[model samples]
Target chain A: MAVSSTALVDEVVADVVDRVRGTLEDVFAAVAQVAERTTAIAAVRAAGRAPTTADLAALRPLLHERLRRRHDLISGIGFIAEPGLLGDVPAWLEWWQNHGEDGLRPLLPDLDPGTSAYSDYTHWDWFALPRATGERAVAGPYVDYLCSDEYSLTLSVPVQHGGRFLGVAAADVYLRHFEAAVLPLLRRLPAPAALVNARGRVAASTDPRHLAGSLLRSVSGRSCGPIPLTLVTALPAPRP
Target chain B: MSKLSNGALHAVFAPVGNLARVDAVVRRLADAIELGLLADGEQLPGESELATRLGVSTVTLREALMALRQQGLVTTRRGRGGGSFVTAPDQPRTARLGHRLADWSTEELRDLADHWAGVAGTAARLAAHRTEPEDLVPLQRSLEEFEAARDPAARGRVYGRLHVELAAAAQSARLTKEEIRIQAEIGALICLALGEDDARAAVVELHRALLRAVRDGDAELARSLAERRVQDAMERLIGLRLTVAG
Candidate 1:
């Protein structure tokens, strides 16, 4: 009976674990799209090709008129919380906040530090959470991208330029949307699956609490405490 | 980052006349519906420009217009100069899930029924297995209510609450939330079917089976029985054969 119960649990777990991978894939795809667009926009402006007033006309395919309009209308748009306070802040911070406020806010509201993410933690270091596999020394997932609020599954990526990390440009995608959007796309077999972050919090799952407080003490071949991850091998490694 | 001609590249904001630019747009559009600041067919600005003027974006403005559209106050025309215009609002779509019903397939109906039976059955089984004896009265009340309600919407609500109460009785919030979302989705699907009352009967029987299995502390039997209830339900949805014909 125990073995049968284990098998049934395995079937359900496999279904949920696939969702985690799906969530991660969708998130990564969205981020990659932003990254590509960012590089292109930067290149177009930096090419030093002076534009006639005609160049500003909405006829160019290279320019997203809506984005250009937004860049014009919305000052300092990128990956920050209070873009309104961008008055004296550095241009980098302004750029970060513009995208962060508009793009990340609706999708991942909990990650807004200015709103609710770090509202409880005053002056606490953002990168203090046990590192998953991404940034090594950055001080934040700055989950507090809002006005220092507590964020849900927020991640910070330090924008690197000329070897000095020019402040982090962050993007926080909601885990719930990740689960909804991409989880349905994952192919599942009879085995159970899981998405264990560096700290072992089960972000979202079919079996919500089955892995709560189930920490990964080491990424070195961790087993889910006797519930051998039968299909963990199929999941993608986190991007380096 | 690219260097730009500082002043030439300045952000151009369409000035807001007041606090409620987007609201003003809608109200103007609505009032114009009768007064002709808009005619029955005149076009308006695209969402982005309007949102920018209103200090909003296309999406936020759309969300507001969507509400008006829901209220049967406006519609959008396509093609050049196409934008939101006043319309005679139709009856708003209810939470009935009935509007999404026309494309509803028997397969979808059966899948929904089976999912509810299985999830709720497991929940019921768990409740019986774990609920304090004192908890039985509410279950009894819920059970009574499930049968007493007759209107499809009202019965659907009772059906959902029955499963919710059962899951809460099982003592796991994780389980209860999952069941709640499942129930909501199922509610939408259930509304599409003509035999929702019959589905209620299926839930009641499974509720009983779950109660018995849980009373026995038979987790294995409980889970499998829950699964069986789902199978029984799946059989009822049109267009599926249980056993393959040779």
Candidate 2:
């Protein structure tokens, strides 16, 4: 029975890892496509000059379509431009998100550097990690009070033009939706299990001791594909 | 509730420790509902599970649930597909706040303020070191909201939110969660003193200065600013309590 349970745990862990990786990869692929299109548009619009905010604004329709296509999984999707790259603004986020039954709407965060309400996106891990490494990244399992007021995971890919770091194309996944999609597999394991980010923060868990957003210490698990997540199965309590 | 909401709910249901068990349980659930940590109409864990989580007897859990029901913070239904569900209470009235403040002794208030100061100061200092200038935006917005608030209750909520955002800027999820729990415990009581115009103005200046210190990356200055702000608020609250007692 113990051997069978161990095999079941391994199978469940692999399934959970695959499900999470598949969902994240879909978002990354969609955002990467958006980035490629953005680069192409920037080249055509700028034509040897710096692209203006209007040029960026023109991509709004594309963002709306992308958001609509993945509405079930993606709560928001858009591009965050490098400061001064658009010529007209110090910072820019041409983002759109689902606003309940009212459908998708543009995210107009405060951008003025002098104001208290400015939403400087430069420091956010989703934007910063990809920009720094020039690679795709997954940021969070944290409450996203700024956009959804829901716990979220933001996947992003750096948008580059001729090796010049332009910005990032990103998508927000509601952690609730992610959980709804992934938790059943976790529940299938006989032992307590969890999916944790590289930072040890639990993204989802069947282990009551390791609740989501809480850090896991001395965790052991297998990495979930290219994403920095691990599937950890806790040993069940021994019988008294 | 989402799984993340489950994490927060766990904090709400954490063991009641050695306090008046039933009362502590009631307060924990009540505060979570009022603070919007528990969503309206959200189902709580089953009684057995909840009892185990709180380290209370089923009987004690029932008594606390009954108290919550009377307070209109929770409702229970019978039969299948039924469980206790949260019903967010209205904002605690100002008179109720005075009564709540009266419950705390001067020494207890001082101790609470000390803890608050320690947490807020650490958060501010770390935010100064870790955040970019742009990351201060949410803190700035919270400050403006506090200044524009027309009533004491609104000011109190915004004040708590500002500190919570400060922890968020520090980029420590644990700190942010701690700030939320602390706010739920003492947030409403602070409204007693924030109602005064002079007190409000003083806080506005302190918040502005704190923001500048964090923006300039002066970690020690930011920590001091944060500590002073909380201590000042505590002093005002203590003065009010004395006047009422006299």
Candidate 3:
């Protein structure tokens, strides 16, 4: 019994250690690419006409193509008048509720539902954009798309123009990209790593088996050594 | 449920009760019973007996059965008909990274840079601290190769590897998933419009600084430099208009 218990602890430690190391590496690599392209004085100068509607319209297809190429992500983006139909906070929430995956629905109750400024949604708004200049940044620890269960974390900086909201010219890195940083930290200890948004839902997790259903509020604080384990009391226990 | 002499089986599962592991065992049992690997309506040995045979404890074994029961993959009853019976097969669902990057924002992109620089720096520091002196040769070799490479595609490949290695070193799933999201988001974006030359130039400095940090075991310095490198790199993308001007 002692031997087996020791092995279990060992396995848990090993897994956490393994995942943390991975997360670190993954995060560095993913963040490293943020500066791959930029708005050169020449490039921005190339946009000399203040970007007319025709220019914008003509650019969508190419931008979409650009968006598609850069991320290969299911969700796509472009500069639009209304943040696009699904981009609006309320609409996106509603869309996600109705047309999205069940795994994602549980997170909605926590959304503020009042404005477009949720940290997860609009941190890129003028107010938050230039907060970081010639310095470090941690973006979206935030949400870009809710329906897809896509959570994001980024390393970025703001775009500035004489201290004006030149727009948040930054590289968008996905949260999953940080797996290399987080998982290894987790693998080092017996505890699992997960995020529970303010609404008391499982935001993201290492063991899918340890779903929002099985997560316990109590588990959030309990630590076995430095490794923390979420108990099955707070969230619904896994689908047992 | 069947009256299985699962004493041996229960013994086998006693120690492995984590839901995921148990889930797998139940799935296997479902397959086994269906394929006649274990007979239908067979009265298997008791948990102890089963545990003894499988080299697990009855507790773990029962947890597996319970999961199968919950999945409707098995049934348990008391008395003679009280054991575990195969009922349903297992199914799988998964998440993908590509789907994630679609909704990214400028702010989030920057955050990705911060996290990587901090955590990866730590991992490098740890590796430098713990790696055997003799083992440093291959590490140095890998570094040499990375420094020598200049092709964007090659850099991209190296970029992928450096991350996995860092993750393997930090050994955390949290880092791995975060890295996945960042890589998928950036990778997809680059595939969208970022040029090879653009990416290579952006990361070369960061990677080189990171190597230095690792070599020096300077976690803090590694983190700061790595972060600066990432932020500088991210600034490469052009910004979306903050709002549609009236």
Interface RMSD of each: 17.5, 10.6, 22.6
Residue-level error in angstroms, candidate 1, position B193:
4.2
Off by over 4 Å in 3: A1-240, B1-103, B132-154, B171-177, B190-199, B238-246
The TM-scores, one per candidate, come to: 0.32, 0.56, 0.27
Clashes of 1: 43
Best-to-worst order by lDDT is 2, 1, 3
> A180-227 in candidate 3: lDDT tens per residue?
334444434434456443223343455665532122233442222221
Docking class of 3: incorrect
lDDT of 2 by residue, A128-196 (tens): 899999999998775564555466899999999878899999999988778887787777767677888
In angstroms, what RMSD does candidate 2 have relative to the true structure? 14.0
**DockQ of candidate 2, scored on C-alphas against the true complex (2 decimals):** 0.04
Better of 2 and 3 by DockQ: 2
**lDDT, candidate 1, B15-124, per-residue tens:** 32354555534443343232222334444456776576556657657876786576456787778767677563344333213333323456655666666666666665
Q: Is the docking of candidate 2 incorrect, acceptable, medium or high quality?
A: incorrect
The C-alpha lDDT values of all candidates are 0.41, 0.76, 0.40
Runs in model 1 deviating more than 4 A are A1-240, B1-99, B103-118, B192-199, B228-246
